[model samples]
Structure formats: structure tokens, C-alpha cells
Target: MVSRELIARHCICCGGGNLEKSPAVLMPFVALRVFGHEPVEITEDWGLRDLRQGMAYTLCNSLQCQNCGALFLDYRFTDEQMEALYRNYRDELYNEQRIRFEPGYANVPPHYHQRANYLCEVEAWLAPYLPEAPAVLDFGGDSGINSLFREHNQLLHIHDISGVELVPGAERADLERIRQCHYDLVTCSQVLEHVPYPLDFVKQMLPALGTGSLIYVEVPHEALLRAHPGSLQLATCKRHWHEHVNFFTESSMRVLLESLGLVVVDVLHLPVDIGWTQGEVMGLLARQA
Candidate 1:
């Protein structure tokens, strides 16, 4: 019998029940790389017992939506599981545990503290669509370190679950405050890939937008997906599931935004050089219709 949590009942992007399945593994360590890890005996110490099968690493399927071409892990993680996986969130403690599991894992924290180089280009691309001094809200933007238009924005708000300290000039906000206040632009960057339900996640931010307010969503155009463009056979290529579970295609992204009653103003594939790696980002700029 398969664990109910390991079954994807419907397409997360298009709500389609028809999906194709392929073999994939849920890495116990939750590190980025799927291969070249030091073989360590699986144990409950990693805190993924519920997801494991009698001390064996969890073997699961990758489901691809036939309707929209979105590839994602078949497993639907619970809120508690998500919290446990991201408790320290790349801090020293988190890195120590991860390094213990995969010695090849680079223990150095990826530049979460530094502002991303791509945001400058992102801000420029969005300049024409936004007000001169937009009230910006960065949902899931940790520390507001890379919030776009920071200097020019009338107000910069950071709404994140990580509980990381905000940089100077960035105000912290809760969901209720987000509902009460309207923002000219809400940026959900580099976050959709990790979420189980992208549609529901974006829907939560809808109330913050008044008419014509724009939401900028960015996700990595994962190497596998880009290499096999328009091919639904990505499940075969993506044999391991890490923090980034959902692999979005341009068609799938458009479907997600349109289903939410948002107008897709533009979809761009932007090049990025983030010190550690050079890759592409799929940026979707949408507005309340």
C-alpha cells in the first residue's frame, strides 16, 4: 500500500486529474543535489520518519500534468513536515546537519544575506508597469534583502514565515496587515518552486492587491526543464526531489495565473548570475483583471 501523502490526486496548476507518473526519490537530508552524497544509514534523527519507509529513503513518483505540463513531486507534504524541514532554514545548525548527511554539500550558506544581481534588471523591466514610488510587498522574501525597488518604494514590507531579521528600512508584516493594506506591487520571487500548492499560495496574496495592482512571481527555470523544453518526460530526468518540488513551464505558469483571474501582462526568461551558479529565471508579471 502506498502512503496517501505520496499520491498527487490532481494537477496543482490546472486542477487536471490526468497525470503521468515516473520514479523519484525524496532525499532525507533535504539538500540540493540529488546525486554524489556520502551513503549514510537513514535514521529518524533527520526528522523525516513519517516520510520514510522503515528507515529506507522515501521512494516516490514525480507526477507530470498532461494538461499543463507542470512536473512536481507526487508527495504532498503536511504543514508540520514543511516546518520541520525548514526550521533553521540554512543557518549554521541546518548546514551542519545537511553536511553530515552529504559531505559533498557545500556548508557555506548560499548568499541569502546578499542582494541578488538579477533584481536590478527585474526592477527595470517592471518600471513602466508600476507607479513611481510603489508600495511594495515581498511575500516569502526572507529579510527583504532582495526586495525590488527598495530605495524608490514609498514603503517596503517583508512578509515571510522564516522569522529572519529584516534589514533597515524594511517593515515586517503579518497576514492580517497584508489584508488591511494595499500594495502597488507584490513580489513572490524564488519561492513558488518549493511550495506544494502554488495556486493556493498565490491566492493568499490576492487580497493585498487592489485593482490594477501587479504581482511579480519568479521561479528558477530549472536546468532539467530548460534542457527538455515542452517535453512532459521531465519526471524521468528529475529522479530526485529536493526543496524545489514544482518545475514550472511557461504554459503551466500562464495557466496558474489565468486560473486565479489575473491578467498575464508579460512572461520573461531572464538570465541570472548568482555567484555560485548561472541560470535562467521565469518571471511572470501579472495584474488583477
Candidate 2:
């Protein structure tokens, strides 16, 4: 692709404009899988629509927040781009089997852990805080399986753009209702990175949370990945530019939460899998002061 100066994005953490490009770059999504920077050559006729051969169509450049140490993809997708990409994201990259498996590992599906290990920490820390028959809202909680692990008797509602949530008895609430309803706990896991304006999105939902309510957040750690390069081959072998747009560091995440007038209760750096020498994702639990 044509090399240009990486756009300086407003830091969600520090509210700074010092985001700069990183040394690491990977292949574009259409050109390859999440394995490396090289093209994987997809010729399986999975509706090969737009084929362009150049740097502009190939490289997925990474950006770093010079002020906060967080890493993110500098490339921002437009409304049209987001629609075209997500329309077939799960179907192509995952469902149709476009993803590549690493050495010695079977081709395991994504969201390999129905109940993420990090959630265990969140679940434990949340026990003392939850009310009797807690009303839980899992924003972007895919399939609502994670809620099953939290509390059985709890009133659970799942909010997701994808309509594939298969949990029994779980209510599907829209943004309007969720914004008005007061929830005991609001979980936003792996959601911020996909949205164009994460700050504005949170601003919209903040009113739905009542006093003493908990907001549990999880995101991939860019700081850990930068420090541990070898672990990346397993975590993100190829670049996923469309989805994981923003990667947060521990310090950056704390600043982001605190900036929104929420007190940080705890921050946990969790491995991708328990006891494995690999990449990490971060979990943050916070509530209004």
C-alpha cells in the first residue's frame, strides 16, 4: 500500500494526539490469515470480489500511543468499509474456514473458551458486590454462554449486534431499553476495539448503569504483545485490522476508565490460556464513584 504518515488518533486513555506507527506490520485481511505478514493466497473462490496487488492493499500497519504506550491499528474503516467487512467476517474468516491453524494445534474454532479464564477472576471479584437476584447485562456477549457461568438465578440480558445468541431464557435487549434499565452488572468484553468511537459508545450506555453497579471490561493487551513478541505467533499470527482496531495497555486502560468518572476497582493481566507461555488480554472492573 501507499506509505503515508499514520494518522494521530485521540487517545481514549490520555486524550492525547501522539499516536505513531510501530515497526511491526502484517498482511491485510483479504490477502492472508492471522498467521504472519505474508499473503496466504486465497483461491478457493470464496466470492473473491476486490483483488488489488500493491502495498496499500497488503500491509496492516500498527500504531502506538506515544503518550500512553498502547498499540492500535492506525487504519480506520469508513461506514461503508465496516459494513462490507462485517457482513461476511464471521462467515468467511471463521465459518467458511479461511483461518489457518498453528503448528501442533488442531483447527480449533474461535472463542475456544466458552467461559474465558479471565472471567473467572471477574466472577470471583464480583461475588461480594452483586445483589440478590442480580440483573446482569452482557453487552456484546456472544451467544450468552459466559453468563451461564456467572449466576444461574440471576436475571441475564444480552445485547449483541450478531443475532446468534443461543442461550435459553436470556432476553435480547436493544440499546434504547438497555440505556434506560438499571443493571446490577454490565459486562463489555471484547467490544470496544471494533467500534469507531469507543468513548462515545460508552457515553451512551453509562446512564443505564445505576449507583453501585459494576462494569466489567476486557480487551487485548498491546503492551504485553510488544514486550513478548514470540507469544504473538500464537495469539495473532496474522493481522485482524477490521476487528481489533484498538489495543489497550494497563496504564492506558486505567486512564480511560478513570477519565469517564469511574473508579477503578481492579485490573488483571490474563494469559490467553491458563498456564500457557503466550500473549495476554486485560480485564478491568470499575464502577461510578
Candidate 3:
């Protein structure tokens, strides 16, 4: 017997309307054959892989949330399914496998030594809002590569699905522990898109902070994607399209933030000069109101 799962009633962001499902555009994998040379790559088999086999691709349909402009799959996978996906979510698999990176990522400038430079950029951006040795909560900060406070004596905590947590001077950011006190800043980069409900993700994280606390969010500049739909599909495909269900534009992001009682301080359109992926990423700085 098939089990019945609860459906998300309205737009996860705006709570305004039903999410509309759209058709699939791109495929992440290529053909493998004995005679033809196969290119080595590391790609998570996002439910969309098998048709010949009995495995199913439940969310091949795109669920676009018109109210807040978040386009994602409408289906809410069960905890069991989610566990299966993230239980073995390895951050280093891509590196350990030495999977050939997309030409765009390897040819990108920010790819090499990006961790250090990224920290510098983040430091500069948060300088105004951050106090010396400020407490930082790195939500979904994989292996803490995006943290800038480790060098300083600042308190930095990382919470991620990846089982491994290894960042110097950084402790595990437990959700319950985070709620104990307000933090100086919160950073979530390249994470919102992965979540099924962007609003719930923010809400869960928001309680850990309070008014005057700052939140820094970075996502693919999907607004820029309007100009290149094909590239958008390919980008999502290369980035593991199944995992990234929500697509947000700048205006949509602002709407979502403002609805949550946050003030948008800044928005940035970050175009890649170097990296395994080539595209525009939007950065937003907001303060809890």
C-alpha cells in the first residue's frame, strides 16, 4: 500500500498560492557505453536518473511558487527519504573521487584558494554589523570553509547535514543550542536552494537570532537567469537539480525577507570570474527588525 504524505498548503515563502508544477528541462548525467569514452564526473543521482530501472523520479516536475517566485518541486519527501539522501552526504566525495569539474568551475578564478578569499570577502561585507569577536552561526556551512571568525577568537558554530564537522575553533551548531542565545550574525550561502521550504528553513534559523542581528544569504542570481533559461536549466542540472528545488530572484528574496520582519540592507549580483560552476550568485545582507 502507498502511504499518504502531507502537502505544503501554500507558497512556502509568501503563503499566498498553490505551487504550480512545470516540466523538466535538463539532465545531469551522460550516456555510458563500452566503445565510447566516458567522461569521469561526480553527480548525485537525484531521483531523476532511472526510467529503465524500477527506481522512480517522483519530482521530475517543477513546482513553481508564483507568490514569492520560488520554483521548486511540490512533493515533500518523507524523513526516511531525506535521511537516505543526507545520511551519507559527503562533502569530500567530489574531491576524493577527483571527478572532473565542469569546465566553468575549473576555469574560474575564484576556484583556487577560494576559501581564504571568500572569508576575506565575507569579513569585509559584515564589518559594519559585526562586533570584534562576534558570535557567528554558520547554518549549513559545510566543513566551515565559509567561516571568517575562526582566525579570530570569535565564537563560530557550524550546523550542516554532512556528518563531518571539522573547522578550527568552531563547534557544532545545534538548533536547540542556537535557540539558547541571540547571535551577532548568521550566514547561509548556497543552502536555501537545497531546502524544500525556504520559509521554514529561515524560520527555524531565525529564532536563534533577534532584532539587530544580521543575516547574510547567498543564492544563484535566478533573476539573471531570466535572460538565459537554457543556462539556468544546465546550471541547476550541474548543481544537482534534484536537491535544488527552490529558485529565487532578488525581488522574491526581498519579499520573503521583509515578510519575516527583516530589513534588507544590501543585495549583490556576484558573477563568477572563476569556479567549477559559472553563473551569477545573488548576495543579500539583512537585519532582523
Task: Give the alpha-carbon lDDT of every model.
Answer: 0.83, 0.62, 0.61
Q: Which sections of candidate 1 miss by over 4 Å?
A: 1-6, 31-56, 107-110
**Candidate 3 has what TM-score?**
0.69
lDDT of 3 by residue, 46-110 (tens): 34464343322222455555555565554555555555545435335433322242333333434
lDDT of 1 by residue, 20-50 (tens): 8888777868622332243356566778746
Clashing pairs in 2: 1-55, 1-56, 34-237, 34-238, 35-237, 35-238
Candidates ranked, most accurate by lDDT first: 1, 2, 3
Writing each residue's lDDT as its tens digit, candidate 2 over 21-75 gives 4433533453334322444555546455786433333555566656665566655
TM-score of 2: 0.73
Task: List pairs with backbone clashes in candidate 3.
Answer: 105-275, 105-276, 105-277, 108-274, 108-275, 109-274
Using lDDT as the yardstick, the better of models 1 and 2 is: 1
lDDT winner, 1 or 3: 1
TM-score per candidate, chains pooled: 0.88, 0.73, 0.69
The true-structure Cα RMSD of candidate 3 reads 8.1
- Give the lowest summed-lDDT range of ten residues in model 3: 27-36
Which consecutive 10 residues in model 2 have the weakest lDDT in total? Answer: 230-239
What are the runs in model 3 whose C-alpha is more than 4 Å off? 1-9, 18-21, 25-59, 91-119, 223-240
**On TM-score, who's better, 2 or 3?**
2
Instruction: After the best TM-score superposition of candidate 1, give how far the Cα of residue 44 lies from its true spot, in angstroms.
Output: 22
What TM-score does candidate 1 reach?
A: 0.88
